[model samples]
Target: MPEPANALQRLHVHLNETRLLGSISSALYYDQNTVMPAAGAEWRGEQLALLASQIHARQSSARYAELVGEAEAELEAETKAELGPSVPTERRRNLQLVRLELERQRCLDPALVASLARAQSKGNALWQTARRHNDFPTFAPALAELIALRREQAGQLAAAEAVPRSPWEVLAQPFEPDISKTRLEELFSPLKATLPGLLEQVAAAPAQQGGLNEAAAELPEAEQESLCSELLNSWGYDPARCQRSRSAHPFSCTLGPQDFRITTRVVPGQPFSSFLATAHEWGHSLYEQGLPRSTDHYFPWPLGEATSMGVHESQSLFWECRVARGRAFAARWQPRFVAGAGGDPWGGVDGFWRALNPMRPGPTRVEADELSYGLHIVLRFELELALLEGGLPVADLPGEWNRRMVELLGLRPASDSEGCLQDIHWAEGLFGYFPSYALGHLISAQLAAAMQRQIGPIETHVAAGQERVVQQWLAAHVWPLGRAVNGEELVEQVTGERLSAAPFLSYLEAKVQQLLASAHH
Candidate 1:
């Protein structure tokens, strides 16, 4: 094509290139997790380190800053000339976002950038082995190195922040902008106070007889895969733009504007694991696919990206917890599951729903019920604060993790794999991301309420096998907002209320009563 005459056009070209590099990094990461061989990790780390350094250089370079400056000057002139608020609003916001990101990138040392990439790659490899062997010692050194590197990173980025922030807060800002520990405490305190009591209520209830066992719940991997495919197809998963694979940990990622990937692992006995995980990951993929990618201004721009990890998680949990685990969905799909397993293991539809909505507290966070999921996040959020700010030693993590698990959920992990090493976030030096998971539950609940208010009941649509209507609502309301707002702002804008633990807690209570009522029948 011809060379761009305008500064804005030139800046678009620059951002497009930057997005290309970032997507390449994502592709490499996806491969590493899904199919890359064990021995290739070292070379992959080196490759990623090189790419990280190059991308940092491009983002922080004087030339890119000059282009951004020129674009801002042109945008201001155009905005002043315009009669109304049509083009200038989103474009102006995009430029502002770009400027802030530029400042933060400029503050980081390139060596540190490269080092962090290598550390993250190495840390992920170490974590996989360590988790598999239940060996925390083998992974502790890498975790310490990552924490030290990230602390230094936070210290550097603090200078670029518009407001004063603590080290943990600084590290967290990239995930949830304008987030503070005080706000997290305010939001999570309700969960801390209430969830355990709810858990106790479930625990104190009499156990239902003839519940599912390992043998009863087991489905072969092939059957699980088939069921997952059916679920995705029923929910609008198009293979042309989206692909599914297996991974150690379930996740979804965008390799490019059109390339979406999700992965889930089938456990030996947990028949629901792969199916629910597929739903969860596809929810993430749907959000990614629905993001603004139509115009050039959207794809290579901040507005095209996800607003926050919390919102992203809300999408996943909406499918996993809200829809897949709901009574309507269980009633709908229980027949297929029984056919796949060659037996009616769950006894009946209500029994299948109970199996899906197992309300008991558990050692594993991924396998946790709605009542206990937020507590898992609370435990991680506090431990992160303790490790990053409260001077908790790395060697003491296992003990501390176990103590918190018992305190919060009344369960203790039997091994390091199930305890401190359960999540891959800390291993990769993600200090402030856990809170978003809890925040997601809250956001999902509140949004669901709003969605129900607008379109009657979600369960009604779900029971009617009209999930497309639900997807249409979210696509119109939620996905297009993108980075125009932060997580809480998005919640308030969509739901007309500030995010809180109330909706999620209320939903959990009602669901628990329903489950108990069914048990009595």
Candidate 2:
């Protein structure tokens, strides 16, 4: 084999081993969330620490660096070759992946990586316990440790190379590679400027009175599970390939090319919570299931993996916001929901729709409405950026979080569980993941617009119970590409336009307006 070919083979071997380790880590994470007892938290932290050290050792190994260097040289030579352009393109792509891994690995010391992994594992447990007791102080020290480690990691990444943008940009790259702070501000500035007024208009509009508010009264867990299964089957999820379970914070995970798992929490009075969460998670699983199988199976290569969390969020938002909250969906499923909750089915489609789109400010990010959801993200983005920049101390997070909640959403959390301890992202050391939720909303609107153009009336199809049509459209245009394209390129390819705030803003304005108009009549 040529030097480049040999390097490529070695890189692949390293990547495959890293991928296996990652898969095991993912499974362990799932276990931690779903089945592991509290007593196991310390051991889990050690296991994760060991795994992180192993992965870091493999990544930072001198042999790996040599292989990457050789691959880079081969890529340059192939770039200069004139005979077969496609070969060079493939080589350059592979080289790009290798270089990205090298840069990421080189940015953080192995000790720091191991420390972060252990901190995150322990922090998760602390967060759970703190949340259960509605106490932030109990988890504050662990959170502070995580914040310190993440800030150090950000600094390390910034020092690895001269980054053109802010340190936050470099830190955010792992979650949303190629996205700049300027771009995020451009996409979000308009929403920030316009949403308050829009929200006021909807809130002042005649209140739609008649929706069910079946507070978590006494719903059985078994019944909730059964209903979740029914909804999953209705959504075309095959039980053999996809499984569901319960977790404190619901999430979806893909174990392999074919295996996917989703979790939902059962809120006693509000059975819709679990059902809707199931739908949201199903959206994510469907995207994973629909990824192009022809490409290699391992993640981090940008072949079968997701393009970005923003794109992945779009899939879930499409199902949860666009489809589940729509008039047609509520009309078809309201009967089942009413029957399950023993509520009045007479709430009418308009009333049910308004209830679904309620614009109340909330403490929980996951339960936030479309209009106010971005505000939640903006709070975290600012806090994390400050933390990364050394402008804020982790010790001040609870106060800062409470202040931001009041400033942004005009509400304050009654307890720490509803405030600083709400999300699992920070506990897991996911510093840059919050913004993707809002970004996903924008992408979903853009993609939905494109789907409408291609498939002719989506609302009509949705109202007529033709979810398969929408699913098929997304599978064909969006899901199959996987990480074969980046988020911006995928948006452009599907929408024939660049990424912009207009599509999302327009969709939100129209939906809110329709809801308001219907409520009045």
Candidate 3:
């Protein structure tokens, strides 16, 4: 009856409406992180909690589940006579994805959902204060609460699943399905074994800094902002379509389809840090800009969204590390750097390249060089496993974090702010997110290798500022497809290589040699 409810059409309308709701929610989140006055956090928290509750209820509602089920039934029932010779492939995929999401939402507890929102809201504020004060105790309680809430959420997911799983594994599924601790250990083992020695060799090399970065410390915030804007335009981001500004931590979010916003923070006296952050966040904005969307709508349905956080991070890292930190790219932009700072601070592109790609370890992960970035992730991943599964007490995290930093990077953080509290992930209850950044580097290298094999040398295009050639290749092979497949499938489909860290490691080893040679000369 009722012509089987026009499942695809109804589902599209409902999903679009859901996307609209999500856009509004994202706007509030953007403002909270960007423009929201610090005093207004309480009101903002309430707004976020209410939105979270409403969205969860709507998504997990009986009628919504029924509609999804009916849509699935229709997919199975419809024949050539009713439909046509060809299947509605896209619609079928969308419905299938939506159905899976609906089932997941159904498993979530509304009360827990609201509590998690509240935890994030409060946790962020406390983290800001704690970081500013360099007081781990101040943020520890909130962190502990957020961790508990995440654990509870993971338990709920595990309860609904057919197979038994660890809490970390269950938590990871939301970011990357089929991700497991066992799998991650196997993948990270090589990097853990190799990076320390590499760091020692590179750091010990002559001309590590080459005195190119001295002028960078004197660059002001205003000048950096202008340079960032120039960099944005150079990357082909439309000013009207996308916006950039300052934030506590650099990030990118979409407030509307055409409204892409990215935030980069300027560290006074560390001139190039913000530039790199801008590049990193811009990569995120570009991915958002390139995702498949409804021509009339800004928010994409599930199939149009990023497949996984790892893939999203890959896109960002590709631009930030693969392109921006490349020797050719540094050569092309040397004139601009001199112009921006009013002098040739780096002396030449060779010195400029060394400054941008540090081989030494650092306290901050976001500011880490390509060679050391994966080690940062490895440290975080090991810490998370301990916190979530190894029974490590939250109160002892600062010490544990410091110990690991010394062990992994041979540099201990001066304070908890630069150590355990550096990232916003734990503040927002994002335990499974760190691994993605390392995974991203791997995917970017693998994908870059594939792109090179298919096209020409990547450096050739990037050096000439012909980024569109690289962008177009990714657009054709990666962004448009979105989450149609999982991360492994996406990598294999594009690169003809199964997911592995070897490509990323190989790429880095070559980069180290290049940096060393540049240093020597």
Q: Top model by lDDT, which number?
A: 1
Scored by CA lDDT, what does every candidate get? 0.91, 0.80, 0.83
Put the candidates in TM-score order, highest first: 1, 3, 2
Error of 2 at 232 (Å): 1.4
Cα lDDT of model 2 by residue, 1-521, tens digit:
44334666666667777877887888899899999999999999999899989988888788889877876776566667854565635456556666776877887888899999999999999989989998788888888788788778877887655456567777677667688877888888888887777777766764643354535323467767887888888889887788888999999998766679999998665556787788899999899888766544345454667778889999999999899888888888767655665665436667767767776667888888888888888888888887777578777888998998888888899888889888998888788888888889999999999999888877799888789999999998999766657888889988999988899889989888787778767
Number of colliding residue pairs in model 1: 0
Runs of candidate 2 with Cα error greater than 4 angstroms are 1-7, 69-83, 86-91, 160-162, 213-220, 295-300, 343-346
In candidate 1, list every pair of residues with a backbone clash: none
Global local distance difference test of model 1: 0.91
Candidate 3 weakest ten by summed lDDT:
294-303
Give the per-residue lDDT digits (tens) of candidate 1, residues 1-521. Answer: 98699988999999999889989999999999999999999999999999899899999999999999999998777767884465657788899999999999999999999999999999999999999999999999999999899999999999999899999999999899999999999999999999989888887875542355547778989999999999999999889999999999899999988899999999787889889889999999999999877675567899888999999999999999999999899999999998988989888888888889888888888888899999999999999889888999999999999999999998889999989988888878898999988989999999999999999888899999999999999999999988999999999999989998899889988998998888777
Q: TM-score per candidate, in order?
A: 0.98, 0.93, 0.96
For candidate 1, the 10 contiguous residues with the lowest summed lDDT are: 206-215
